[model samples]
Target: MMIGPTNLSLTLEQLTGTDAGSVDEAPTNMVRDLIGAWKTPLDQLTGREIGLLISQQDGYPYVLDLVWPMLEDDPLLEAEFYPGDILSSLMRADDTTWRDRPNYKRRLKALYERALRRPDDETEALRESLEP
Candidate 1:
């Protein structure tokens, strides 16, 4: 049976180690290119823009580690982000139907929800030991 094109790309990317490790040199270069392409004047950008840039370049998730502490008492933002959320979503992708999962705008939203629901008992039980 023939797999679909989406599966084909996913298979190729997995074989090439794209999903298994840190963003390789090529993806790093591509992110850099996207940043340059999206050169909105600094004055025009918002927190989301900053978060996205840091996320792409660092391969970090939800921009939480990068932006959380600096956000003051903004529960709105904190409630919106969590460490490992984005990364987990990327890692959980089904090899065949990633694109059809949802539109890009809500991808992070779904990821955050899923991450929040993961077993947190072990995490909550060991705060100091878990600090990284």
Candidate 2:
């Protein structure tokens, strides 16, 4: 299902065990509010939660644009898992319609490059994550 900000807020509340409210705020606003309420490092969230955020059907693009960047430097966000999952998901979503979304391609390319630069041990996992 398409998960917009309100849905995302609910999901975050469920996952993080905090009440971030169900207001239909913009994705960025909801992210900000959730972060504030979470009070913990974003990377403290498990890989599964990060995967859910990246794989959301509706606001995935916005989540990538806004939230992903924030989590990029989080030590808890494993490079092999998080970036690989995001890159794989982005590539899977890139269809004929993706051509019109230059920003998406740029972000996808950037993530791919970042994944490639991971350490040898992590790179293996990244490669495996991308494989069909």
Per residue, candidate 2 scores C-alpha lDDT tens digits across 7-107 of 23334345435665444553676465444434423435445545555554323333443445544553124523543555565556645324434555656
Q: Report model 2's TM-score to 2 decimal places.
A: 0.46
Model 1 scores worst on lDDT over the 10 consecutive residues at 3-12
Q: Report the C-alpha displacement of residue 94, candidate 1, in angstroms.
A: 28
**Residue by residue across 2-118, what tens digits does model 1's lDDT show?**
222232112222323344333334367656433432443333334555445444433222223333333322312421245452243333334432333333324445544544454
**Top model by TM-score, which number?**
2
Error of 1 at 125 (Å): 17
The lDDT values for all models are: 0.36, 0.49
Winning model by lDDT: 2
